[model samples]
Target chain A: MLVIEGLLKRYPDGFEALKGVDVTIEDGELVALIGPSGAGKSTLIRCVNRLVEPTEGTIELNELELTTLNRAGLRRARRRMAMIFQNYALVERLTVMENVLSGRLGSVGFFKSLFRRFPQDDVDNAFALLEKVGLEGLHDRRADALSGGQQQRVGIARALMQDPDILLVDEPTASLDPRTARQVMGLLADLCEEHGLAAIINIHDVPLARDYTDRILGLKAGELVFDGPPEELTDDVLPEIYGGEDWSKEPSEDDEEEEDIRSSGQFLAEEVL
Target chain B: MPVEQREDTVVWRRRDKRQAVIHWFVTLGIAAVVLWCFKLIADDTTWEFVWSAPEQGADLAIRMFLPEWFVDIPQLWRDGELWVHVAEYFRQRGLYAMELWDPLVDTIHIATLGTVLGVMIASPLAFLAARNTTPSTTFVRPIALALLVTSRSVNSLIWALLLVVIIGPGMLAGIIAIALRSVGFCGKLLYEAIEEIDENTRDAVKSTGASGMQVLTFGVIPQIAPAFAGISIYRWDINIREATILGLVGAGGIGMALQSAIDTLAWGQVSVIFLAILATVVLSEWVSAKARAAVT
Candidate 1:
């Protein structure tokens, strides 16, 4: 379980990115964090991993306080949680196998990792995760040689290699197309289910978030406004979280086109499973 | 204002009248200064010698081309020798060929060793100088940058002169000079490359809970590997050319041969030495180009 109590982040310029937010997540729960741009969705997830350090309050993962750990202690804490990025941040020149094996860097000695020598079990696990993510035969290829969707799959494989308790994903599908986005999300959902892993995914697409995740948390201007199951995230609640937009408006032609794409995305998601 | 209203339609001029006038005056001032500098140079030049330069150059070229491959051609001619002079010419050529090989080999060794040593020294300094990789920007980076600048400010020839005096004339002096000069060139470029690496990729690696050194190996090094390779090869190519001249300062290479030939007025031997240096430089250039292309 992960618990955040009064988590606050105020930048040096005195901009409050997270305003005393509190939340708790149980194991096996895959939750979606939705907000408009600059609503602290990214900030909140980063704070959990201490990537963006919190100025005040506490973040506890499995009852271990994260905010006050020293350098070595933080590394130990970080091993229990993994982060995925929007850009699929693979070392572009490195081979896929190397990139995946890098996830075990914290566990290995410096010289062993430096010489590209990972333990055989780590290598075997990397191969297994590569196969699990459907990148079965491209392990020798450089990261930049893969397509964006393929790269994101490699990113997922790398994160899974960490064997972490929680996955902090920051806009994983933001750079992907609609179909590929749903497929990647579906893969994450399936993997989380199999491992009973807790995850906080920051997603922009409302329908996709609602489809894949069990729960949704809405942030608006550094404050948590709504936290509920996906079924309870109604149109009335959206205006409160997203602010003053007409929730009951008639669907436009563009909305109908989007509906078609979403339906096709759903089909692709099912195929991924 | 750059945007103004004219009658009904709005008029947009890139520069208003005041800016245009300022620009024009600036151009005129630069032109006047250039003309004055040209006049100063013209006044100081001796035109009489300048006019005779072509004839002097042609005479020197003629002397240089007539290589001294034969050891006493005039004496052989005076004694009424025919086939004997030809045999003597072949013998002298053979002897000269034997003399040239060692120094040419020495020059190659100097450059190769110098480049390796320089890269070994520069790689660590590059990390210290790079803003992203340095342990402290204010304290560590400035010292590293100062070292790089000091290395770069002095030319390899000057370095060779100092080393020859201090270390006693040999290949060691030539190697150290080349390595010192290369430290700055390699460090500056390597640091710039490091600063431009993809930070997002590094962040991802750090998020894996890797140690600082591990993050450097996995996150930073791979991104800068190609740039490092290209810099090393490019520096080696330049060092090959520089190594030839180091022998002039008693740092052992083909340059020592050239200096002795010039001192004895053996223009032909000087020409041959020049040709050998040219060939070595061209070969190194080609090799460096191919190596850099392969890495990139």
Candidate 2:
């Protein structure tokens, strides 16, 4: 479980990206945090992991108090929570297998990481995770050579190798096309079920988030204005999230869950086209 | 956008009336301050006196040692006897004959060894010095800065001179000086390279709760390794040139040979050494360019 209380972040330049935000997520829940640009969706998610330090608050993940933990302690806490970035953030110079193996670095001793002498289990697990993401054959390929969608897939496999209890994704689909976005989100949804992991993702695609996630958390200007199941996410709630009407065609209750997205096949066509 | 709004006319010409009359006033003020200070220290007799600054600093050094045969030397041109020694150096064969190649080889050897050692030492030091990579900037930063400044400020020649006196003249003096100097050059440069790397990679690792050491190994090292290699290689080439000069103080290598020939006034041998040095420098330059390109 992840819990936040009276969380606030104010930049030294005086921009309040998060204002007294309070939220909690249960174990194995797939929570979609949806908001438009500069709405602090990413900031809120980052704060949970102590990436952007909360100026004042308590972020409790299991026994770890994120705000109170020193760098080393926070790093130990991080081993339990993996993060997927929008840009993938795979070290471009390293091969896919190396990138995946890096996920175990927090647990592996420092000398082992330097020498890249990850334990046999770690090596096997990395290869297995790569296979799970359907990047089995490209394990040794340079990360920069992969397509954006494929790179994000590699990012997911890397995160899973951490054996994290919770996963936070910040705009995982932002750089991807619509079809690819759907595919990645579907993968996340599948992983949540397969591993029984809790996931919080910051997303801009309202319709896609509605289709993929079990619950939705909406934010606008550093405040959580709406929290409910995906079925309750509607056109009315979007204006509250984005500060204006956008893609205003309301999805009927029957149409809230996308039937068009069946598998990677249909999603690839939308992505490529 | 219209050209008129974007472009402005150049102003070049200035009238005598528009000239800043305060220029002479500033110059006069500076001159007056200098003269005032001078007046406070010395009188007109000293000013009028012909100030013959002595060349005794380097020339008079070590004159009282050994034999009367090595005593007070006349200027080469003034004595008109320099050609005799030049002829003798060229004519002397076997052990007495100065071989430019020997010193050249030594200088190159010392430089290569020093550069390699320094780079090995500085690579991890740079990572420790980077504010983002290290656990604390408070300790490593000042220490790194101090190391860099001290290495750079104390010229390699000075290092060689001191070491030569302590360790006795040989290649070791040259090598130690080059290594010490290159540490400053490479550490300072490599640390900056580490600092300039994109924070995005580190951010993900941090988000995963990577330890400081873990982040450095996975997040920072891969990003900066290539550039670090390039910087260290560049410093190696620079140290090679410095190694040659270090021998002027009796360190070792081709410079020692060159200094001996110069001392003996062997223009023929000196010219031969110069040509060899020129070739080596050009070849090393090309090699350095290739090495740098490979890394970057």
How does model 2 score by TM-score?
0.78
Against the true structure, whose TM-score is highest? 1
Ten contiguous residues minimizing lDDT sum, candidate 1 chain A:
A264-273
How many steric clashes does model 1 contain? 0
Instruction: State the lDDT of candidate 1 residue by residue for B7-69, as single tens digits.
Output: 999999999999989999999999999999999999999998999999999877767764343
Per-residue alpha-carbon lDDT of candidate 2 for residues B1-296, written as tens digits (9 for 90 to 100): 11222257644434333244566677889999999988877764554333433444333332321222233336654688666655554465323434566777787899899999888877777777777776577886778777777887888899999999999999988899888888888888888998998788888766666677777777888898898888877887888778878878999987887788789865445556666778778778899999888876
Model 2 error, position A49 (Å): 2.1
Report how far off residue B139 is in candidate 2 (Å). Answer: 5.0
Model 2 pairs whose backbones collide: A75-B209, A78-B208, A78-B209, B103-B253, B103-B254, B104-B254, B107-B253
Isolated chain B TM-score per model: 0.87, 0.68
Q: Candidate 1's residue-wise lDDT over A93-175, tens digit each?
A: 99999999988987989999988889999999999999999999999999999999999999999998999999999999989
The parts of candidate 1 lying over 4 Å away from their true place are A247-259, A263-273, B1-13, B67-98
Write down the RMSD of all candidates, one decimal each: 4.5, 8.9
How many clashes (backbone atoms < 3 Å, residues ≥3 apart in a chain or on different chains) does model 2 have?
A: 7
DockQ computed for model 1 against the true two-chain complex using alpha carbons: 0.80
List the DockQ of the predictions in order.
Answer: 0.80, 0.53
Return the clash pairs for model 1, or none. none
